[model samples]
Target: MTTTRMPRSGSLPAVRRAALVLLAGAGVALSPLPAQAAAGGGGPSSAAVAAAPAAAAASSAAQTVVSTALAQKGKPYVWAGAGPNSYDCSGLTQRAFAAAGVKLPHSSRMQSKMGAPVSRNALRPGDLVFFYNPVSHVGIYIGNGQMVHAPRAGDVVKVSSFDRMPGFHSARRLA
Candidate 1:
């Protein structure tokens, strides 16, 4: 009688990288292990290695949205505005979210009413922060404790650190 063994999926290298990327973000740092070091003679399978790039691309895209919004700092503010000319507080946020492929309502009050509430400390790059007694103002939280918004009707869009803004009520993550 001849004896034969089936290769287990666990033995594949590609499966390992895919699992790692899924477990962590694209930022997962991996040290190259020699093929001989692995249980199988072959290094991690091609699939795992291929998965890394996709995860990295996703993370990079997310970062780009925040950066793009920040880059628009100093642009003029136009009431009831959106896009290349100028922006109101909500218009700035709407444009920023649109850049990241998320759509939001035109009014700050409308926007403040959407999305899950996030704590100030837990805020992420694309989150929206609301302000004022009646929630008349809104800004896009760009991570690192700062946000981008149109300060007033006469002012231009700008980036303000969290401490610089007054009366922050809550943050909402849109993307």
Candidate 2:
């Protein structure tokens, strides 16, 4: 005796239908791709992958620099020393950068010698900006025209408006 199977109503061939469903699901899952990745049609686009780490690193660095600076707020101003007790303008920047694994010189004048000079308009969080006619003071630019610095001998480290500060010079990026 011979036996044969009958096709079910509205049902597709088992193997082909399963494969189609899987493909459709996959297509749906990957639909509406992110703008950075959409150029490649599917899968992770080069731009998206590349930008993610760069953005993350930049954010991490910014956070590290800001937090490091803020943490030292209220520390007395000690000349030429980057430490728990005190810091000068450049010294605070140096220690903050050091906390983020970037090394910098102890003096503002010396620190000014390193890194490309960035204009005030281009300043970003973590960029070091100098002040005073002789570049005697330095501060970490915290964006929005503000900087964290050891302002004076009596005053502790604090954030202040860069506009109000004197002798605005250039900025240095340690990262």
Candidate 3:
């Protein structure tokens, strides 16, 4: 019986591929991709199929983080607010990650220290971007160089270009 072959690893979506890599790095078992099969023996092994769910879950979590944050756009920016209506910089990020089952501190500086540091160029949707010297402000990256954030006391939650934000302290990947 001929089994259907799976796509090459390189062809997987960026998020899924990244998840697979992370799961592998975390010591999750994974079988070789169909492309790695020798000769005509090319199909997804049971282990390869088994690893797909975890990768998909990771991708889903990232999307949830992004969607949750984006939903708060236009909400008022209130100091120390972290809820269904208004939010502060770190509050918005904290709430977003929480929707995806990831816990993040309520302070931008503390959140900055939670996940793996990501270079500006490596940012993807759902990454947490920070600003200022001591990382006093935070935002959720939503791709295409745009991030959702609570700018200040008078500003509402909105999408802004990370490149234009003054400090550009750093970015971190939590999902």
Candidate 4:
């Protein structure tokens, strides 16, 4: 049987889609510098060039995570919900990245410690943004300085900005 894959436009934030379209239009490739190239002795090796696609795939996975999180917007925020419907702070992040094939703990504090530390200025789309002194809240960044997350009980999953989040602490990249 032939299957059709349709673009889920509603799930993608406009900034993400636009950036992706621009990247696709530009035909950009990121070729990392190999030891030889770093020494100024030769051009990037085939391995370095080959790895670019993997990096791109990784980025795509991150985008998928953000889209998944965005799709969960408006879902009810439960204390420990981690599912197709409702979600908690870390649960939302957990389920989002899980869709991208990355495993994450359910606790925001635990998830915060899993990925490399990302400085506020260096954050990119797909980085996990954490909040509170003890890392009590987590959100999936979706570019344009915004993130999608489960705020609290009686509230739904929503988009928030770093400047507005209470006690903004740190961020991490899982993909």
Which predicted model would earn the best lDDT? 3
Worst 10 residues of 2 by lDDT: 32-41
**Model 2 agreement with the true structure over 55-128: per-residue lDDT tens digits:** 11234444566667767766777676577677778778776665543456678997886655677777777777
TM-score of each: 0.63, 0.64, 0.68, 0.67
Candidate 4 clashes: the total is 0
The prediction achieving the highest TM-score against the true structure is 3
Segments in model 4 whose C-alpha atoms lie over 4 Å from true places: 1-58
Q: Relative to the true structure, how large is the alpha-carbon lDDT of every model?
A: 0.59, 0.60, 0.69, 0.65
Q: TM-score for candidate 2, please give it.
A: 0.64
Write down the lDDT that model 1 would get.
Answer: 0.59
Q: After superposing candidate 2, which stretches have Cα over 4 Å from the reference?
A: 1-57
Superposing every Cα of model 1 onto the true structure, what RMSD results? 17.8
Q: What is candidate 1's CA lDDT for residue 137?
A: 93
lDDT of 1 by residue, 58-106 (tens): 3332344455555566667788877656678888776665554344678
Please give the ranking of all candidate structures by TM-score, highest first, separated by commas: 3, 4, 2, 1
Better candidate by lDDT, 2 or 4: 4
* Candidate 3 C-alpha error for residue 105, in Å: 0.9
Off-target runs (Cα >4 Å) in candidate 3 are 1-58
